[model samples]
Target: MNLKEQLMQDMKEAMKAKQSDRLGTIRQLRSAIKNKEIEARQELDDNGILGVISTAVKQRREAAQMYSDNGRPELAAKEDAELAVLQQYLPAQLSEAEVRDIVAAVIAETGATSMKDMGKVMPQVMAKTKGSADGKIVNQLVRELLAG
Candidate 1:
């Protein structure tokens, strides 16, 4: 089944198990997906769903960091819990070494010998690594590769 179908099934299971935390996270995700659909005026495919999930995960992570910085561990923990729930739907993340290797390959493929080539190389690398790697990590790797 597709991501949306999988999410719906999980939501149902959460309801049956009376998992309020899981249920709440799922409902929030569903709401976000619905909002995007309404705003974009189109049905979201798996990649589009993933984009929404990634955005939600990023928002929660930022919120958690902010809460922790403001001395609110309880609130931070809640955000962390929501992040974990959202993360389950994300594709497995690439390790640092793997990301570095991919960045190296992109650099080689694009002949990006200097930092100026970053813009040229990043889009190709991101296209290849989308959903499998984090953009920030990939960007850092690219900078290191170009700097070296």
Candidate 2:
């Protein structure tokens, strides 16, 4: 089954198990997906759904960091929980080492010997990593690789 089908099944299981936290997170995700569909006037495939989920995850991570920084552990914990739930649907994340390796390969492939070649290297690295790697990390790796 596809990601949406898997989400529906998980939502049902969450309901059956009386896992309110999990159920609520799933409902919120579904609502976000529905909103995107309405806004776009098209059904999203797995990749599009992933983009939405990825956005949600990024938001949660940022919110959690802000809350933690502002001395709000309880709220930070809640955001962290939601982030964990959202990440369940994302593809496994690549380690920094793995991302660095990909950046290195792209740099080599594109002959990016200097920062000016960054424009040439980043898109290729991001394309190869897709949503599996965080863009910020990839970017940092690219810059580091190019600068040194």
Candidate 3:
């Protein structure tokens, strides 16, 4: 099944199982997807929906960290739960070592000799990694590889 279909099925399951947290997270995702569809004036494909899920995941991670740093464990736990729910829809994440290897390969492929080549290197790395890699991690790897 497609991602939207999968999400709908999962939502129904969550409801049936009486998982309030899971249900709420799914509803929020569905609402976000609907808003994006309205804004774009068309149905979002799997890629588009994945993009939305990625954004939600990023937001939740940031919120969780912020809450934790501010000494609000309860709020942080909520964000962590939401993050876990959002992550269920994402591709398996690349490990730091894997991302570093990719960055190295792209640098070699592009003949990127210095930090000045970051503009050329980053986009290609990001394109290759896509949903499997986190942007921040990819960026750090690129900078580390290019600089050294």
Candidate 4:
């Protein structure tokens, strides 16, 4: 099934199992997807849906970090839980080694000898990895590879 269909099925299962937290997270995700669709004035394909989910995951990670830093473990835990739920919808993440390999290939392909070539390299790397790898990690790896 597609991501949206999978999400709908999971939502129904959550409701039947009386999983309130899971249900709430799924509903929130659906709402966000709907909002994005409205904003774009078109139906989102899997890639677009992945973008929305990725943004939500990033927001939750930031919120969790902020809550933890501010001495709010309970809030942090809630955010973490939601993050875990959201992550279930994402494609399996690329390992650091896999990301590094892709970054290396991009750097080589782009002839990116210095950090100045970051702009040239980033898009290619991001395109190759699709939504499987985190952008920040890919950027960091590219920087490290190019700087040295």
Error at 49, model 2, angstroms: 1.2
lDDT of 1 by residue, 43-141 (tens): 999998998998898899899999999999999999999999999999999899988888899888888899999998899988877777777788898
lDDT of each: 0.92, 0.93, 0.93, 0.94
Per residue, candidate 3 scores C-alpha lDDT tens digits across 1-148 of 8999999999999999999999999999999999999999999999999989988988998999999999999999999999999898999999999999899999999999999999999999988887788888998889888889
* Superposed model 1: Cα runs more than 4 Å off: none
In model 3, residue pairs whose N, Cα or C atoms come closer than 3 Å (at least 3 residues apart or on different chains), thus clashing, are: none
Residue 118, candidate 1: C-alpha displacement in angstroms? 1.5
lDDT of 4 by residue, 12-33 (tens): 9999999999999999999999
Ten-residue region with minimum lDDT total, candidate 3: 126-135
- In terms of TM-score, the best-performing candidate is 4
Candidate 3: which stretches are off by over 4 Å?
Answer: none
Estimated TM-score per prediction?
A: 0.93, 0.93, 0.95, 0.96
Show the colliding residue pairs in model 2: none
Model 3 Cα displacement at 115 (Å)? 2.0
lDDT of 3 at 128: 84
Candidate 2 has a TM-score of: 0.93
